[model samples]
Target: MSTFIDIHALQTLPPSNINRDDTGAPKTATFGGVPRQRVSSQAWKSSIRQDFSESLDSSQLGLRTKRVAEKVVKQIEQLSEGYDKEKALSEVAAAFKTVGISLAEPKKKKNEEEDSTLESGYLLLLSNQQINRLAQAIVEANGEKLKKADVAKILDTQHSADIALFGRMLADAPDFNVDASCQVAHALGVHESEPEFDYYTAVDDVVKEAEESGAGMIGTVEMMSSTLYRYANINLNGLVKNLDDSEAAVAVAVQFIKSFITAMPTGKQNSFANRTLPEAVVVSLRDDRPVSYVNAFETPVKESAEHGRRYEAAKALAAEAQELSETYGMEPVKSYVLAVGDLKTALEGLGEETNLKVLLESLSTDLSKVLAN
Candidate 1:
């Protein structure tokens, strides 16, 4: 079943560039002298998903299987009234296995030692020999000769040697519910002032930095980058309750997430970033000679042509991405990629003597206020 969710819930206050210089003054920089907070798109995704259920993925028994197994067990118990529960269950499982349903003997947990008495909570525990005897009894009761192949198939698919299970859903497609759940409706703005930098991101080598820091900060722009681009994934399941069906799943999911977003002539674009251009530009700069980074509060750059090139390149990519999206498909993956290109280009061009500090101070502070809380 598909759930209809509003995309607005996904939006958030723009990220802030609230860090200070070594002297404890507010950080400053310029991209046309305007400061911009550099929040990555991913930080937003994680923070929001966090507000929801943590047990969402723990549906261990696969919903459909549990439901069907329940029905199957109840039906068999009545028929095998003369027999014990175990014997009755074995007989019915054989018949279902004879049909085309795919059933399986529940997998045993690796850590559990197999006892002759069987584990207390395991729903299915009949041994190979027991299953055969059960199957034989079932065939005799039905008054039909059962082909071994048919019996195996039915048992493997439908009569999952299982009883107690969880995570069953009434509806088939679970992903549609998740996709339809969230949307970032507002184009929030970022700001230049705050008590602290919402985050400090090291450029280029995120994994190295993560390893060095012991524990990485949560919901940082860099963290967003690391999650989607480097780790985790956004998957699309098919149109229906089809599982392990890649083609169907991809088509259903792609169409789903893409549909929630619409291009508009006049609508606000939300951003979680909040900083002045000079501040961001300063941080973007990678000075490898000393293997150290310049602070937004300490060094300013807007004069160097190299710095200009990097800023311009990043802008161009972002513009290109927007243009491409407007021109063609604004596939989420592609759009985000272009945005990242903008960020990487900007970061690479930072230099020691640039002069964007003034421009950042001058941009509309209202824009900054719009994104950050």
Candidate 2:
């Protein structure tokens, strides 16, 4: 049976545009007949990936870009002494072609010759180990060339932690596709919210008081503030299978939990400085399946005169989760919680209350035992 790890958080952000639409306004979604501020899962996943680099080694991570050929070329040059840029590019192109990924022809610039940088048709996700192995293979080939089966095998296995968690889709090579072991939900506000605009101006610093009487520039930025409910889950079985290492899987899981809890989307952060920690967090280990408490606010939470939205939202979430678990007999095998203010009391029965440090330590220990089996 597959075990699932579900992470839920209730966070509050001040006036900020963490995720925006094409019109440069904060994203919003209508729920329960009311509009609520929204943050895309893509945005949060990116933040989580960025956070991974801080704690994990670069070798355990992957690179997603259209310049896979160029990266391979650089690696090839570094691995061999005699190979120049042109020779390395040729070898990289031939190697990718063997695996059914054709490098696009170099596009010429205006009044200049064609650029030699080779790129794939779309973004490719590759692990550092895979790149190194491929480069070594090319260097070892010594002009004999690599076989399709060999190149395909290298591309299919040895996935990095991020690739194992997020997965990858290769349209040109469907056989090499990797299904993601994790799912992230779009964060939604617990209560109705409306976009608010900030209108301001900047004065020309060089202009004197007599030279300029008015501001030099003026503009408005759309933003919103609200208490948001964020949720995500990871399939431990899938992650372990992708990584092919239980120990590494456990480490990745720990880092993922910490990143998800702390990483914030940095959209317009310089302007608003809206960085804040979650008011409450719940991590649940379930043998049956993952659960999301987002529907708990389907009716939309309301702030009380004494308690704010975060407190009210946490209370509602706890009540809803308890009722669901009891009614459906879906109680988790283990649950841990980190909360502040009145939220501690509100979510006491939800799980074992602890601090972030202790919670992560306990999680790593528990995950090891579970994955060991």
**Best lDDT among the predictions, by candidate number:** 2
Every candidate's lDDT: 0.29, 0.91
What tens-digit string does per-residue lDDT give for candidate 1 at 39-122? 333333333223212322322112222224334444445445554555444545445445433344445579976522211122
Cα distance off (Å), candidate 1, residue 9: 12
- Measured by C-alpha RMSD in angstroms, how accurate is candidate 1? 19.7
Estimate the Cα RMSD of every predicted model relative to the unseen true structure: 19.7, 1.3
**Candidate 2 clashes between residue pairs 3 or more apart in a chain or in different chains:** none
How well is each residue in 1-373 modelled by candidate 2, as lDDT tens digits? 9989999999999999999999999999999899999999999999999998888998898999998888888888888876878877888889888878888875666899767788888899999989999999988998778999989988888899889999999889788889999999999999999998889999987775568678889999999999999999999999999999888988898899999999999999999999899999999999999999998999889889988778889999999899999899999999999999889988988999999999999999999999777
Candidate 2 residue spans exceeding 4 A from truth: 106-113
How do all models score by TM-score? Answer: 0.24, 0.97
